[model samples]
Target: MVERVTATEETLQLLDKLKTIHGELMFHQSGGCCDGSSPMCYPRGEFRVGDSDIYLGDIGDTPFYMSKDQYEYWKHTQLIIDVVDGRGGMFSVEGPEGKRFLTRSRVFTEEERRELSIS
Candidate 1:
């Protein structure tokens, strides 16, 4: 299957620890607020998602989403979620852990783009 979003090993480990404390989590990236470049993680049902958002698949079993406008610009690439030492966004769940979730990407290859009909 073509995965639109995936997480690094460090990210997965972080998510596991977070889940134990927060139950379930979800991620959203928007063009506004604190999500301009950072993927904000929230407890499930904590963040409201509407029609303006697009489901981008999951990372570490956590549902991921992006603003539709942001998706338009990012659809050509695959999202790779990683964790780094730093403070997270003010509203994100990872702030207390001293690690922030980061977004890294790779452009889709020709074959993958063709499979997704985006070539």
Candidate 2:
């Protein structure tokens, strides 16, 4: 099955470490106006998600969401959650760990699109 979101081994390790400290976590990526378009992580319910957000799938056992508008632009690609040595969004849980969560993407092929039921 095709996944809308996924995390690298490195990213999953970081998430597991964060989970030990923060418990369950959630992720949200809003329009560019929020955190310079970087994805932000918060305790499951710390950040309220409502009609404006769309669940993109889970990465590292964490739910991931994006503003409806943001999803429109990203729908054709797979969101690859990665980690790098740097500061993340000021409010993201990983920011303090001296590492950052980065987003990488790849456009889906026609076969993949069909499997994902994404036209």
Candidates' C-alpha lDDT: 0.88, 0.86
lDDT string, candidate 1, 14-39, tens digits = 99999999999999986543222689
Per-residue lDDT value at 52 in model 1: 95
Global fold similarity of model 2 (TM-score): 0.92
What pairs collide in candidate 1?
Answer: none
Residue-by-residue lDDT tens digits, candidate 2, 1-119: 89988988998999999999999999998655322246888989999999989998998889999988888788888888888898977889999999988888889899999998886
Per lDDT, the best of the predicted structures is 1
Error of 1 at 89 (Å): 0.5
Q: Candidate 1's error at 84, in angstroms? A: 0.3
